[model samples]
Target: MAEKPGSQEAHLSSSDVSAGQLVQDWSVKEERRARRKIDTSVLPLLFLGLLVFQLDRMNLASALTGGFATDIQVTQDTINLGNQLMFLGIVILEIPFNMLLQKLGPRKWMSAQVFAFGLIATLQVFIRDRRGFLASRMFLGLAEAGYIPGAVYTLSTFYTRRELAKRVAILFFGMFGGNALSPILASGILKLDGERGIRGWQWLFLLEGLFTILVSITLLFLLPGSPDTPKPLLSPGLIRFSPAEQDILQKRLELEDNEKRGGAQGQPIPLKLVWKTLCHYRRWPHFVSTFAVFSTWSPLTTYTPSIIVALGFDRIAANALAAVGASVALIVVFGFAYLSDKTNRRGLSVITAHVCYLVTLIVARQVHPHVGKWSRFGLWTAVNSFAVGYHPVHNSWVQLNCRDPRERSISIAMWVMSAILGLMTGTQYFRGNDVPFYSTGLRTMIIMVSIGMVFAIIQVIVYTVHNRRVAEGKHTSSDGEEPMIYTI
Candidate 1:
């Protein structure tokens, strides 16, 4: 008989072994090596791709503070309308885009979307009226709709559940990083007010959009295809894992499938599956929690620069101040993500972040009328950090529990849709009439975040109850053993 795999004999030198032996004998050392290779090969591209995605989308926030509204002949209300239209496009197109992603493959489909949006963003430099602004924003939204959830699904394919949270955080850290960089970049670019007969805001759009196009072009070559299809369009061996590494990854995926759905793999996501996932008792709370959390956060993100300007800072100073919130978010997101992954308590981390956010909201509410300018600034900075920081844990919770890739895709889409809805509603709170104090908006955020905490608690209870039922044999698993417990 051949020596047992991963046994003493498995340590034989690679030169002495066949490919079959290599696959059968993948050891922990090799597993670590393969994981590191995947991380280096995959994540930086994801970070850059996501950074561009966010930069193109959120650049409008910085631009608005930099006289974009004035030059484009639009009011603050028109800018708000454009933002809503963009998000509406995203909500409408998200599901369809993800459905096509499975067929066209992530690289090809995402590359096309990125390239299209880059062109749209570049075209913003030419806008001279509300029509042009709205048209450009609407098209940009439609082009960028599914990129995020598609990227999440792609990451799911390569990483295990245990390893996913930190990776997701790292991926989304790119978004906060883009947020951190956006104002600084916009401030610098906006300095080109009349360098070539272009407005500062126009220069901001043109340069960032051009940079996006360049990255999209690079992605055609840089983004490796899926594990099943490792070749880029014209490059073979561009992202090849060793044969042993591939085998190990495939097996780990299979093991997870078996744990979740009785070894079923490649099940198509039909309408019924989607409906079931939508109604899954344990899943809905996550959506609600995320919706509420994002509702409170989105306006803060979209209008923070504007708020800083409201505090009497010059446009450049306001934009520069915006980076402080993102810097804090970057630090907090990574730290909390590491702890969530290490402890496998994704829900708890989310709850903690929410609590921190709520505290900031309360403090902001108290001080907005009574405190000095700098104190309110500090409070807003803390709110932004916690608001953005919580998202990775929320995503990880959903991803780990779904287990099925098809289900996960739909689930992520659903959550994203909810988040967009939250954003849309949140934007309504900070109307022009409420400008200086925005007391109504602050109170509403406090209420919504409080609701999010409740939803988070409900999810934890549901997961715990399900796990207990499986442990007590009140329900049966297909494998005739305890079911794989849901991630808490």
Candidate 2:
């Protein structure tokens, strides 16, 4: 069963007396050890789910490298439309599935989602036409829609604000790890094209989708449900938390919320609250910045292998090489997260990531038409490496700005939806006309990222102004949940 917030909410809040008091009683060493336990038990399962989610969601590009387009006889334009429809499914169901999370709980609903999409992904191996491919992609998106944000929200409940930034970075490793792993896996699996009377792309989808279905079973039994229900489905034999550790896990977050939000935890946010947060102007900059920034990523993920192959590399080597930048991205993500936690500057970390990415794009677009193939490959690698580094920091920063638990969930949902929309928009940037170089698409991305940077700057300025008001007792947050601090 998916764990819902109920009796545990009051129980947890009653234990916290004031801001920071609940945490003070727990020794720093003791808490750290307990946190390590939670990380091992909870984070890995979450990471694994996302790894498969991203693999299933993004494998079409990898399949293209294995001759997906030739077998299906779909043009690049049709393929791009498939990707867009997939993201559209995700966008359509993002909020509705989130609403479902409240009813079904994270574990049950998320596990069901894993299985739903896994089956759809596995079935994709049979598609021989454009409509079938497009339909499968859309259904895959529907299955994957709310999983990311829902996972992030559940993660928020398990750790304190201080602990969240780094954990968020770690959790995202699953996605970035998949980005790196997908191509490598496809490169290997694709070699078995004729082993069982299957094409290379068919083997790619069949193996990867079956692997994801197996993971769905693991998710159903191992996800720990929630902080209150910290013992996972197979607890006594495999993963179990002490009562003391569970107490620390759930209460630390409760205390953090009580101090910042003046509110309780482990409850569903109302639909009106959802509407209110949607209309809240303070959070819009993050959404806009996310939209602009994430839009830069879609074409990169969908085309990097193709781009490298265009550099005259072997298709197999191209698929394997595509993982390089994504591999590098894992480190970039962790570095930004560590810096944000170390320096206490989420804004600075995110801004620096955005700046670095924009500069990298500027460099890539400047690449001479006659540059060496390997050198161009290197440039694309660097671009993909820096592509998503800002994302986790941006996610943590967004969380820091919200007023209460309910708004926190709603805001995170908004951020994920906006980012997905951005990805969907970016799929079209590198059109069929762009061909191998995609120089025009690079320029378009530069413009979009520049716009994203502007929104990021606007967010910083807004937060800076609002922080002063908060210090002066004029925090203008809505009445439902009061934002005590605005992080800049």
Candidate 3:
């Protein structure tokens, strides 16, 4: 086989080329494997962060029922006002905070916010009057406002539209799960009612706040900043992308561009945007529906335990009943979100949830005070389950309709603001003198729920008609590729 020198040189060159190609192939495979592994690990951490965030927010409601209000000499109106103030702060700060998050990234900003809120919450034990509690609540609200929407926006960045509903549902389930567990935690903490000169409510703040702080610190190490960011935990084998995988990533970017260009271009969301969004004929119905429904139950978080206590149940039983509401909420949220995603119909799910709420509220209103404790518990649980289930679907509807990120952020903030406004005003409806029965408040809630139902129906009609126009290619300009349709 000893040929000419030129031929031998060419043969060696071809062999070297073949070896290089094989190495490249191996590298690509390794990268793919590493990406999958990293995704698996990071997803769980994201879920954990969401869970803890929600837990911290709702724990205060349960804690307050453990005598925090009396110790601070505050009324139910004052407690709700504190919640209202917190939400007001959230309304004021959400956009700026979200923008800061976009600049600083979630890993730094979200963790810092969580840590700050925990510190403030822990310090709340020293609050001696309405003003101090109010100040603390406002700070807490400001710190926490960006967490939920930021998480939602972050999730959207990772998952496709098709995969988002389930992921969002899972994240929210963690939140409700925390809400469910808080009462149980409160039950145990209440046992230390007067231990170490610290009140039960103080222990509630201290323990939960400490736990949150610890979780935030852990997250600083565990969380992945974004999809493109690399971590040391990922194996080298998975770091490289195959030709096909690279193509897929490129296509996704192209699609994102198309979407951004097609949507209704508005000025960067400002206070005026809120008014403009409100005035959009297509959007008002959904906004009103959401306002009515959320407003009706806004007091439930702060007042449910108190309501249960007034029903002649002990503090522990009241807390337990609140847990039942959380459990029921979990079931409804999962069920409704699944169906909504499967059907690709956010409006129907919201409407169905609202109808269920209406029925439950009516039933709750009619239930006899002379009825068995079990019956009363069942009634309240049924109402709460419907209410909780309705929340996610409502939010999903809003998110789905919002094509512009800036507009979406503003819309969510406004929705939350409206809800808080209702809570602030609604608290006065449930005076302490109306305890045990709360006839006026219950009746008002029933009317509000009914009004919500009407608005939900109207939104469904509007969304359906607009979607039909989109399908027919008759309404493509205003709503991007589709007509702007809003659903509650």
Candidate number of the best lDDT:
2
Model 1: lDDT to the true structure: 0.79
Candidate 2 accuracy as lDDT: 0.82
Please give, for residues 133-181, the per-residue lDDT of candidate 3 as tens digits: 8999888887777676666665555544555676677777767787778
Worst 10 residues of 1 by lDDT: 258-267
RMSD of 2: 5.2
Model 2 segments beyond 4 Å from truth? 1-23, 234-237, 259-266, 474-483
lDDT of 2 at 160: 76
Per-residue lDDT over 1-488 for candidate 2, one digit per residue giving the tens place of the 0 to 100 score: 21232222223333445543553345455557778876887788889999998898788878988888988889999988898998899899887777677566677777888888889999998999989989998898888988888888778777777788999898899999998999999889888888878898888888888989998888777777666666555434156778777776666565566634311234666889889889988779899999998998999889989988888988889989999999999999999999999998888889899999999999988983768988888899999989999999999999877766667777888899999999999999998888898989999999999898899888889988887887888876456555556778
Which regions of candidate 3 deviate over 4 angstroms? 1-47, 230-257, 260-281, 469-488
Backbone Cα, N, C clashes tallied per candidate:
0, 0, 7
Q: At residue 123, what lDDT does model 1 achieve?
A: 88
Score candidate 3 by TM-score against the native.
0.81
lDDT, model 2, position 134:
90
Strongest candidate by TM-score: 2
- What C-alpha lDDT do the candidate models reach, one value each? 0.79, 0.82, 0.67
